[model samples]
Structures are given as C-alpha cells and as structure tokens.
Target: MESENVDMNIIPPQIAGGAMDAVEKRFFETEAEAKTFFENTSKRLLSVNEWGKYAGMSSFQLMDAHGIRADRTAEPGDFIRIDIPGPGTHAGMGYDWVRVKEIKELSNHEEQISYIIVQPCSHPMDKDGAIAHFFKDDATSTFIIRKFGLVVSAEEHGRNEIPNTDHGKFLDKSRNFVVGMAAKVGLSYPQWKNLVKGLLQN
Candidate 1:
C-alpha cells in the first residue's frame, strides 16, 4: 500500500474565494500576453484565481513565475478611482476620479513585480506632478479597491497612521496608497463608450 502525499501549501480553488462572475472570461499564457490583451481590449487583468475559473484551468496553470496572474490595466483617458486624503484637521476626504496617463509593470529591487500606475494631478505649484502608486504583486488585496465613497474612506483613515491621516500629505513627502482602484471589477472610466466600441468592431 502506497501513501499519497499532499502539499498543504497549495491553495485549492474552493478556498480561493468563489468564482468572480463580475469579470469577463479571458485567459493569457503569460504576462506579456495579458498586457497585450489589455492594450487591445482595454480590460483589467483578472486575478489568477479568477482567470482560472473563467478558463476552466487551475491557478498553478495561470500564474506567472511571481504568482501574478493579472493586474488593473488601463490606458490614457481612463478615469481611475482614488480617495484623495483631505486636510487632517477637518477630517474631510475627497473621493475623486483621475485620468490614467500611463500604466506599466516593472520589477523592484527584490525582484518582485510592481505596476507603476501614474496619473497627473494638480495640487498647486510645489505639488504639481503625477500621483503614482507602486503597487507590488503580492499587495493585491491592499492595492485595489472595488467599493467607493464613505465606507472606503473611513477604513483608510482608521489605519495605523495617526495624526496626518491625509493621503495627500504623504504624497507630498513621496508616499501614496498601496494602490487605487477605479472599480471592483473590470476596467474603469468611459466604461459604456469603450464597451460599445469593442462590440461594434467585433
């Protein structure tokens, strides 16, 4: 009688959080493939688990060497959702939308993959520049946000950092949110118009 050994480290699909029905069904063999898909279709990259369910494959089959299956993909003219930190004194926050100027992925010093999602912001003379988020591959959960408005604002404000809880203050000193999301699922901004364009071409 031979005993079957199982690896406990492997996360099963059943525990990978149920299938993501809100996202469209798409599959890519590699990161480059995924990036190309976004460029052509203007679609956000789905998580490895989401892609697995959609493609009827396993997570192991979908993830890259870095365990990154996909990321939030956007092109210029896209309105990405960001919660701008307001003045700490008044606790007033700004739930705003900014246009995406550029989106690209790069590797960090530790060889971890990160996406540099950049959006130009005008915050008066000294603060005028792009607000970029260096979202690491492993920080998926902390990086993207689905819901917007008061609920998210409250959660962010209550985080560890006390005193100046405003995100803008941090950005002024070279800091920003782990990542900002436009929507929970799929691409953000100019949604309907882009959908129509894709459909007409197909």
Candidate 2:
C-alpha cells in the first residue's frame, strides 16, 4: 500500500473513461489476451457486493499481506485503488482510492493485493475524480465508499479522519449533488460536460 506520497497537487484535465480500454492501449501480453483478461477481471473490480460494503472477493492482486477496513486502518503512505463501476443511467461512476497505515501481511505476493472496505458516501466517485450521475430519480440513494476494502479502525471519523460524512447530507437523490462537487475541483472532464454544454448553448 505505497500511496501516501501521492502528490494531490496535479489534476489530469481529461474526462475519466470507462469500458476498460484494453483495446485502445495494450498493457498486457497481447491485444486478445488483454481483452480476455480485462473482460474477465475488470468487471470484478468495479462490481461490488449487493450491500456495497465490500468488493467481490475474487480479483485481489495480492492475497492477505494487507487488509483494508472501513475505519481508515490504512496509513497515509499506503496504496489504494478503486474500480470505477459505472455511470448512472446518465453518467459514469468514477473510481476512488485511499491509504493504508498498517498490515500484517509481509510477503510480496500478499502486499500487491488491493485492500477493500465499504463505508458510506453520498457519492461513490473515487478520490481521482467524479463521474456524471444522470438518474431521473432523485429519491434513490447510493454510497460512494472511500476505501472499499479496508478496516474500520476507530469510531472512524473522529480518530482516523477518513471522510465519513462530506456529501452525506445530499444522500437521497444525489444526482446533481456529487457532480457539482467535481466542477469546483477542476477534476471534471467529458463526464462533467452536461451542464457546461448547456451553459455554452446560450
């Protein structure tokens, strides 16, 4: 979980993309092999349990060298990753990351595995950026978890300060709610183009 040194200073000014672009760029052994691996594995990364509290238990890069609990058990220097699941009916749900502080697993194989834990967030967009949430329904609720598979170390917000309740007030019907936040940070891109386009129309 080598993540604390992450420089939050720079923001990539591009729209976050979905569809697991193994096609556009080949990072694996071969294009077809990449596609197959991506198709099989990528969905598992984005998809979460019905409770949304934890990710599905299969695609861990590492085994048990580390554990990610909901309570901010991770330290600032630890690494974190998230699989951007989807955009709402209208937009994409971006991925998020957090840090890990302590871990019992020391083996190289175990350390590479990503930790997961689900807490509660009005928006599930990852720390990287926010995605468009274009649901017509304003009554629905979704959770944007910070550290998907981590431990809940303390009373949570108080002792660890893992962002327990930032967008929470706008939980139900959080469509415009989370999108608005992205606009302020300069992190929004193609995903955040809807309202901006409308503004330009006039």
Which candidate achieves the best TM-score against the true structure?
A: 1
Tell me the tens digit of each residue's lDDT in model 1 across 1-202. 1113422111112222111111122444565654444343322232222222222211211222232222433343344333333311111123222333333332222211122222323221223332322221112121111111111100000011111213445543233232222222322223322322332121
Q: Residue-wise lDDT of candidate 2 within 100-197, one digit each (tens)?
A: 23222111321112222222222223333322232111111111111112211100110111112223224423634443334334333332232112
| Cand. 2 TM to true fold | 0.20
Worst 10 residues of 1 by lDDT: 150-159
What are the runs in model 2 whose C-alpha is more than 4 Å off? 1-76, 88-93, 105-202
**Candidate 1 overall Cα lDDT vs. reference?**
0.25
Instruction: Give each model's whole-structure lDDT.
Output: 0.25, 0.25
> Could you tell me every candidate's TM-score relative to the true structure?
0.21, 0.20
Global local distance difference test of model 2:
0.25
